[model samples]
Target chain A: MDLAPLALSLQVAVLATLVAAIAGVGLATLLATARFPGRDLVDVLATAPMVLPPTVLGYYLLVALGRHAALGRAFEAVFGTPIVFTRVGAVVAASVGALPLVVKSSRAALEGVDATLVQAARTLGAAPARAFVTVQLPLAARGIVASLMLAFARSLGDFGITLMVAGDIPGETQTASLALYDAIQEHREAAALEMALTLTAVAIAILYGVGKLTARSARGA
Target chain B: MAPDGDRPSLHVRARVVASHAFALDVAFDAPPGVTVLFGPSGSGKSTTLAAIAGLTRPAAGRIALGDEAWFDADARIDVAVHRRGVAYVFQSLALFPHMTAAENVAYGVSRALTPEARGERVRALLGRLRVAHLSTRRPATLSGGEAQRVALARALATEPRVVLLDEPLNALDRSLRRELAGELREALGQLGVPVVFVTHQSEEARALGERLVVLEAGRVTHVGTVRDVDDAP
Candidate 1:
């Protein structure tokens, strides 16, 4: 019945979703519009997390952001703490897991916008970036919102990667999923059941919202 | 020397090797006024306009508006689409579906204009197109003729150096097409910029065109006064 784990999960998930949404939309736009060498390679690498085992992804993150790595060293120098084994680490892990969902859905959404409309904006004295902001982004918004919701849901339920990257330190880094695991291990059946039900209900609500947005966008199109 | 020496004319020479075994190689000059790019489907009329607007790159070409060169393959000079100051009314109309008619027209208004001046210009344009009553309405709510007018209004709002209209009236009924063709001709005549109007319909071409450039199989088959082209064997 402890609420601390759920609160921490909410905080981490919100931050993770923000990170994922920004990076995901940017990558999606580049993939949808730009032609460049290694474009497919970039797409594959971005989408790798979705199919890669969580443990493998966790291992990569650990290596890439570990205390000995330059990124981790730089983080410590600026923030006076290493990135791993912290709530920030939980955010990073969840963000990585959530990114491919955002990217895939957002890319589809952006690509669905009428190319002629963008070209019209270009002809009307709008720079390419201006046209994207004023025309393409607004037209693709509902689907992008749905993608963000999916990402938030994914961030909320992240388990294996969060466990590996942000150790389940009691009261500090123990998210709902981690705490549920601890509860079941300790034979706290009621607590485990309650946490499981809560996570499932939240996820279902988010998915239902996503479905509504997607359906409306399809109809609108 | 050309008769209209003081007026800016769009001179285009292009060779484009398009996909699906299609190739476009054409050259012509559009003097100030309506120059109808008359051609059947697949004759690359839209591609010609696109090249002039910098929307499509030609394999080899020089597109110059009077003294300013918008694109030159040999010179490796290609002005960006927005920078080229070309107003294009696409075949689909391409109105910003999310915006109201007034907002759609206002979008291309120059940033150098003050907010008050911008709003006034948008209002004047909508009024001129006779779509002032539909300013707050979205493209979905507008009838085909209404939408066409709004698209024309949006194109002219840019005060472009040149105007390109690709089958702008084709989607309307015959009566509406005739009605708008006159309005379109009058609207474009006042701009004094080189206007390239594309259409496969000879009637629409005759109704709006002063000069005509006929395209067949991606090549300029003829270029002359509308009367001369119609009188040809």
Candidate 2:
């Protein structure tokens, strides 16, 4: 019942959330606004993770980032370390699992923002980047915050993907979920129950935050 | 020579197929005074303004202020919306919900040399629009008239070559619209820049317009001085 796994889990979840939020929000904005050819295809690709099995996602990551893969070789050669079976790998897996939640929710939020506000910003001499930062992003913030929190929760509870790619390395890749699984197997019922309760508390907090955001956005509309 | 020999004129000849339901073919010349785009709903008044502002692309023809072409379909010149230096006051106000009225006004003055300069510009515009008291308030807290003033202040802070307003006071009550209309007209007159104000109300058009361009089903049905249009056979 070491505390190391708990700390690692928190770190992985936080990093995963950060990564997912930045990339997911950018993708969401593109999906919400841009109108190039094959935009629908790009949108589907971004959101496919929501429906894809976590194990399948992990399997694809493993194929592309495995020690024998060219990308894995280049990464190891540059960094002097392998990405597979590392805590970073757990973060990668968790982020992929959580990304679709951020993308979908933030896209919906960005779309809900009145186009007139963005148009006003443009007409008032603000560039596209400036307009988005000043107007659209601020207006869509509630939904973005809701989506990020949901991503964090998803990353925290991720099991199948983390297990497949990062494995169950003690004090490194052994996140709280992995530790809980181990505790149950080793007959440490108390440790298993503690980890389960902790995860449930985190989930409830995130759900409450998301609920408030949804209500606020509803009121705004 | 034409009157106002050196002053730039906004000359627009745009034919835009905006959507399946709307197509706009309009041509007009506006000097540095309020030229009202008078029309009922769905008559492409807003679309015409949007085209001039570079928010909408024309299917053909050109738009120029003096010699500088804002858009020319044949020449392949289309200015970016923000680079066009045109400000718009939307019918919906479109005030930034997250910012105070002061901040919203400040956003239009990106070329201000310093923070103090930006603050001064915002103050001057808010004062001119008589919404200085609402500077610290968010748009949601402001009354419709106050919000309209803030929107006007935001538009003017850009120091734009032209200001386009889409039914700027339509959201207010009848009394408020009437009160603000007079103030808005005075304020716009003092700026000495071309103002394309859109309105469906004939009275509002007559009250605020020096020149009137009447649209019907996306076509310019009439273009003349307000008095001339009113007296037309």
Candidate 3:
């Protein structure tokens, strides 16, 4: 069986996880610590992707990052290529789909850190950002790592948004899930089963790792 | 100018409505010595400390260290907590659990110090607090008294202009509390900065206080020397 789809999926998932993790942690920290006028609205928007239908999210992404949009135009200007129907589009879709998991989990982890410890740090001459980096972030590292694994799993299996944004171009944008779907539609049972089992195994491994991290953190706490 | 000459006094006059039922309206002065904020639970002793430290904003009041105003609601001037040059040992002794005792102490030490100087300062503070031997250990492994000393060491690491201790020894047993109280007094006596020590225990207050500010139901009941307050009719 051709492994192009698996290779492409891994590449996209890795990039998507990196992008999602950075944005997710930042959003999570802001939500956990700061109070602003539109705080709740920002939180709702951050979490909308998780609960919204994939098609809805896909349509939104298309509108927001399509050729006519500012972000899309900027990207095309820089890279000389449109974002939609490309591997870059796959990464963006997966990152959006996986962002909520990272944000929710990371926010919980950050908030779990003792508020008094942060106060003590502040009183001990640490600025707010310094206190977060030295105390809160270290305390919450385990949960954040687990969140990253969950994000990776989500990114790897992204289908509907990826399909809508990236489109299925065989050997290019056709990721593992898309390949599995294509195989079954063509009555290729062996190829379909192989892809299904592989994805399942990888997901299970990631979930198991996440569980261990969570258990370790619980015990440490 | 403060009567104490070069050493500044902490002057706090503030009103905080913690909730519909609990409002703290207090005013007091802490000169360059231990000034015990004596009150029962829920009397707002800790809240008063927080307000001075700039962690809690008072609705309308002013907090000043000598000539410099740390917080002034009317003037709209509130120094951020870190820039206030105030060190605080919380009631829970909020040591950084992820750091070793030495690292925790070093954390507040001036970054202007070279790494070696910082290490030396941490060592000296821990040694002075009698927690030097436990420097390699984390807070979780330390006993209550040991953790208390480590917390005190961390607070003093910065050589703050003011120090706030919120019942730092309250978690210890009576005997340990007595033993550590003496050490705390000796350590604080040498600082020459205004020290605000909070406690609900009358004994602890008397043991450490040079001046006493008593609170009852979020209002200042009395402010006098320990002797004056105790000797009152």
Each candidate's lDDT (Cα)? 0.93, 0.89, 0.93
What are the candidates' interface root-mean-square deviations? 0.5, 0.7, 0.5
lDDT of 2: 0.89
Per-candidate TM equals 0.96, 0.94, 0.96
Evaluation by DockQ, superior candidate among 1 and 2: 1
RMSD, one per candidate, in order: 1.7, 2.1, 1.7
**Stretches > 4 Å off in candidate 2:** B228-233
Q: What is the descending DockQ order?
A: 1, 3, 2
Per-residue lDDT for B109 in model 1?
99
TM-score of chain B of each: 0.96, 0.94, 0.97
**Candidate maximizing DockQ:** 1
lDDT of 2 by residue, B1-233 (tens): 12465657788999999878778999998888899888778999889999999999999989998889999999999999999889899889899988999999998887646988888888888888888888999999998988998998898888888889999888789888888889889988887878899988877877898998888898988888776555422
lDDT of 2 at B59: 96
- The two-chain DockQ for each candidate, comma-separated, is 0.91, 0.86, 0.87
For candidate 3, write residues B1-233 as lDDT tens digits: 57677888889999998899999999988999999888778999999999999999999899999989999999999999999999999989999988999999999999999999999999999999988999899888999999999999999999999999998887899999999998999999999999999988777877888998889899998888776555422
TM-score of chain A of each: 0.98, 0.95, 0.98
Off by over 4 Å in 3: B227-233
Clashing residue pairs in candidate 3 (N, C-alpha, C atoms within 3 angstroms): none
Question: How well does candidate 2 score on lDDT at residue B190?
Answer: 84
